[model samples]
Target: MPVRPLSPELAEKARNELNETDENKMVDSLQHLKDWLAKQPYLKARTDDQWLAAFLRGCKFSLERTKQKIDLFYTLKKTAPELTPLKYKDPKFSEILDLGVSIVLPKTSNPAEPRILLMRPGLYDPNKYSLGDVMSVGAVIQNIMLMDDDNFVVAGGISIIDLQGCTMAHFAQMNPMLMKKMTVAFQEAAPVRMKGVHYLNTPPGFETIFNFIKGFLNEKNKKRLYVHNTDFESLYKYLPKEVLPTEYGGNAGTAREFTENTKKKILEYSAWLDEEHLYGTEESKRPGKPKTAEELFGVEGSFRQLQKVIMIRELSPDLAHIAKTELNEDPKQTPEDIKHLREWIMKQTHLKARTDHQWLVAMLRGCKFSLERVKEKLDLYYTLRTTSPEVTLRLKPTQPTFINFLRLGTCIILPKATTGLHPRVILIRAGRYDPEKNSVADIMCILYYMVQILVMEDDSATVIGTKIVVDYEGTTLNHLVQANVTLLRKIVAVSQDSLPLRLKGSHHLNVPSGIETIFKLVSAFISEKAKQRLKIHKSADELFEHIPKDVMPPEYGGNGATVAENIEYWITKIREYKSWMEVEERLGTDESRRLGSLPSDEAGDKGSFRQLNID
Candidate 1:
């Protein structure tokens, strides 16, 4: 089918605005870009006229610039498959398409008018589909536009983000990691010209995100951006009723009809979409340099987590301000601290560390930006391998022991994530795994990796601290007997002293048979400071007083997911950080390179098997 027709007047406008040349030059330029793609060792892309022409229009027909953009466009498809996976028709993937949350209204009489993309974020349930899923589906539609929507290519596009039904929960599920990446993808990587962005029914918490979004906008987008907070009349000034859907008071059909039509267009291109997966950049084949997450998002975690930015993303803007105030520091000064730390870290010959803004911010927040403590904590963190290689160095995710212990449903990170000052709750079933099969060291190793991932990704957990709930409901003498005292002491020391997290508060539920003996044994390992924050509860009622039921698992009468569900999620989460862990195995303190002996924390007793306080 031929592409949609743009009016002659609009065609001229597109040419002038997009820096298009005469017809002969346009053809030569198209062929030039196609030839450039054919020559690139790294890129395998669609070079058809429709596909190549859309990119030319988006990038203003600049051959050099379009070549660079084409690289990013395909590179992103390969590097960031999480955003655009191979799942062409997974149930969850299909549901987003069926939901019609992202729609392109049919063209009006003025073919020159830019195509309107109606984005409704609140249409999908946060519980069922994440923001990535929605964005992924939106990307698919945009790709479809390149092939079929001629007006979209020549005349440009506008997005009407209707946030009428959006809630804070929907916002919470959004990955903070996507901020920089999302902006880069849409503004630079994607093959489209976003002329206008209108946000309708803007909510309370969306302002900060909007500010972040606006910072990346070019002058044209900035001028065209519209935020109508439940004011449809104001929107009418730019987008007339004749072009809007019936739901938005337009002469056009209902949103359902627009949705069905757009979906049909996407369905018709399923084979094309399948072939889409084949086109991407093989960075190794690229000339000159390959792009790493470090170059892209700054920090690279196991799963490419943007830890530095996550701190800002995890907290509501209001809470972040409050957190800054408590530290007696200006929010703008955070970069300086991160900068200083990066310089200091690079000077240390014994360390190989990630110096990304997102990662450094999490570290600074954990230490309250105190360089002294930050240095100490970071030193001990890497030195952990030298201090205790048994726990830190050999943590293999693929090992049967790790997987089996993980499947035992022992350690769980509750979905009730820590937001603002609300701590990220980690529930540990102390007696879940058989003591005979695994030593306390092995269990502590698993918990160590879990907490490692938690602190690394969860800036809130590092900033405000984490809430730990250890359930000893099913403990026995055998469990305590196998618990190695020295290894447990190292675990306590590493967490309490080395890690940057506040360690917030620890709650012990259903203490085993000998309460005093257990407390004394535990007290020997933890510092006097951690002792004050420890809360030992005799009953669930007492535990509920400090730790609310709403923030707990469903098995405990909380309004959250069941323990089984949590275990599944936590395991998957741990697995996601496998890349980070494998990288971690190669990175650590080489004591031989140190100028002096680094001080160690070992205050606990070395005796027969006994319990140690895990703070």
Candidate 2:
């Protein structure tokens, strides 16, 4: 079923069930603020509604100690009466309260409904927005937070030191240097580590601590500081140098340098994040170690070496051939080229390179360089074709022989049939001795020629033609002669099924000539009792005399051959005698009466005197 438009009732139901109200009020408000800011002239900085929202949040959270919170809110509220909601915005207050609630928000959970007090800046005209103008609200929030007192930790060397107060005694007591070093080492040694410094009693002013951190960070004795995290509440306690350490000695180990460098990097990172917000996990924040080649080149490194190898291999012939030639010429190549080739080979771990021969073959096949140039350019990549017996077993579609067989449409007598060789044998003698091409041509030509002769001509002509061709080719013929004989036998077998037709006193004998040859050849080859029977009926004259003999008698060799031959001969004779019988019948008065009145002996004489139809 197609979806229908939602009805008012359904919309109202959804709203009530979801308890929806001002679903995107915050976002809408932010967008309005952004529009207003965009319309401004001078005050309009390079910022959007999201930036405004973040800035507003920072001002509320950092400006009034609104983010501070005590673990025991109820106890703190009782013990410190000033810890009321109104006092939560006090610049001196450190603890912030979170009202409990449950409403999921993206990127953050809202169980702790923290609220920050905020006030609009009283300075100005709102219609001065301009392109590229920036409102440093986050920077302002950071500044305000730094002005307020908060616990501060400065990490350096192997320690994270408490920078709450300025005194050697306190510094030694806190051991900030050792703490900083430990923090760095711990992170390096283990997968994860964290350390914190707390200032619960007396919070120092922001500038005093900030200046101290700056000095500590500038100290040359401190070890390098790799990573750091700072909260806005404690920003005031940090030294200016802690924000950017690069300013000190082009490094970020000292508090001063860390602060300076970080401020810049974060500013740049923030701008980038705003432009391209590809948010991910904390791990993704850290840049990966530079690749070796990439580090060496500094700029976009050149991969030409690897690319060249690939191109050469792609263009080269099978590496096997190259390797074979190389091995033949010089088994030992130069050390450097060999080493380079080996390195290249090692890089291609997918190749089975356990043996030197295998490795060489792989290289020859993988790379385009010739094996001959292995020493000079170090060639690789050689491939070889493969064959399988499975190919023979595969069933493929082919045209039927009758359909594909081409007919010459013209027939010729065998060039030398009087002799013994078949036509195919003669063609083989004339054609080149190429088993692949010439032999196939000869087979096709002889087969087609045989078919034409069998189907078009009388038996004698076919026999004479085939015989002459066989004789011409002589005994030099091989398989062609055998194929010819087989083909001839097939033609003879087919002819046996054709209908016999009578013409005049003779009958059209449908027996194929090749069948006669086939029988003769088989008789000659087998030398069985059937051979004698076959020879006796080689012609109709020989068989006609034996028609009266019992077909199954030993006199006719006790085989079907004599009867079959006599039957065939009589059929031919009857066909030839047709016209005479027809004329006699048509001219019934005289000829038919005479023929009908003739005695058995006279009739036999007349029939015997009739013209013989010999093929």
Candidate 3:
């Protein structure tokens, strides 16, 4: 959680418009809203304090407007479940997501820079997934961005709707009522400040859909909409090509690649989307009579039109060839392999393992489809969880201390992995440690959680091994004292013997003077084979020879994103899997159910293990 420094321009805007120039005012505003909302019985949705502050900021710190928008936000969820559905896992919704209809661009010029959302309705099939589904997918993406405190709150958003191949049939398929619902939801319910909407290459008869949509938008937003009919030059006047994707004559990757990456992100945050669905207003529990859909929107039959026949888009020869190549190159496990692995695990009565296909596939891929190895790893994996309560039971991610440790960016899994080996890179900012707050056990717990998540996310490339970059720029003798030798041994033992991953390479960057003593103490516990893979680099430039700079964060003179942004991405991902992690507490090998007794040397004595200190 790096503190986003407010630009002078943004600071002035906050002072003049929102009257919130400092932390104290923001805190007071948030507290005021929380107290006000506590008295509103109808507003049942669990509101985050940070989100409340965002709402206040959006409304220029006007409490009355904020309250109104909050009420309408939950109300829209109840009335427009079609577009604001409770879940994104629905098959049709997922299809739209997979089709790459809409995506939020990755890089922003600055912290206060507005995000550009690119939408290509021409590439999708309206017959298979409706226009409402497209809007729903976009809404989900917007909601996820809104959760980012720095990106959406400080900066706003802009949209580029490419209508190059839109046909009259597509317009006929559009449900005006659904369009109205989506428009109202975006304008009133969502906290996003839509700076503008650019329509690219608008085809003939596009006015039919445009007019219908504009009828619902407010005058302010209606003025913000721009129709650029085939004039890329004019569109570039408003949005520079530097910020746009290559397909749109921008520097980023191809539009197809951007869309695919966006789909992956949507899937990564699906759990968060599902949790959001639960926070909406529970209409059934309302004290007053709930408003009916018909009463709210008037007779819906007025906006109904003849449903046109759905048709799938035909891919061009180049795109078709690329799709084929991608399908072949994808390293994900096949359906048949997943099925076989699931069946094999279930049939192994001695293992007493009950797991999903995903978990099994991860293990199988880690072992390169070796069932015996996967089984062994699975047994050890669950055994460690069941036996070592300190690592699994006491490692609660929701705890404040754990979250603070995570925010320190002490350890993060880079988005991209190594090129040749494709092992996921785990960057450990050892210099960021504060021994006063975090102990050796705390560090071990965090490492355990990171490895657990990395293994789960790993495929063939990353599962086999992982690359670790340790930064020891700020090491002191006190830090070495905090690194308990006993705990270090336990961590190394479990990683080597139980975990399925291999330590492919370990690069120590920014090694402080006399830090070799600390490494010597810790290395004594690690095996010689592991020690052989470790390299001590005095500079990031030296480390770049072994680990490519492209995959490393920019803070280390790499081409990738800033360290803060990368850390934020992983934090959001960790929060998304919070529920699953909680369930994992009960998921471990059942020693009582095993056929044979535990091994004498391997098994822990009944009362020898130390007790976990829960804060």
In candidate 1, position 63 carries an lDDT of 81
Cα lDDT, all candidates: 0.72, 0.25, 0.66
For model 2, residues 1-615, the per-residue Cα lDDT tens digits are 211222454334323432222336335545555565444332213233333333333222221121111111112222222212232123221111111000101110121211111111111112321000111222222222222201100011122222222222232222233322222222321111112222211221222233233332323322332112224234223223222223122122444333343344434444443532122122222235312223322223333332222111111233223334532322233223444666654554223222122223233322223443432211111100001111111111121221122111111221222322222111112222333323323333333223222322222222221111111112223423443433332222221111111001111112333444434543332223323333223443443343322222232233323323433432332333233223322211122222222111111112211111010
- lDDT of each residue in 1-615, candidate 3, tens digit only: 323446786676567656677877777777787787787766665556656766877787778898888878878777777774425777877777777788878766665667888888987775666676777788777766666534566567888999866654466565656665666678887777888999997754344356557767899898999988778899889988788888788897777777787777777776766677466666666668876566556545544431211111222354334323532312233445556656666765545454544455455545556666666667766665666656545557766667777788888777664454356678888768787866556655676677666655444323446788988767666776765555555555456555556677888987777777667766765667778999988777888887768889888998877788877876765665565566665567666777654322121222112221111
Clash counts per candidate, in order, are: 5, 86, 0
Top-TM-score candidate index: 1
| Candidate 1 residue runs with Cα over 4 Å from true position | 1-149, 158-192, 195-215, 219-315, 417-421, 602-615
Colliding residue pairs in candidate 1: 302-580, 308-358, 308-359, 309-358, 522-613
Candidate 1 or 2, higher TM-score?
Answer: 1
lDDT of 1 by residue, 106-153 (tens): 955486777899988888988888777888888888898888887788
Task: Score residue 439 of candidate 3 by CA lDDT.
Answer: 57
Better of 2 and 3 by TM-score: 3
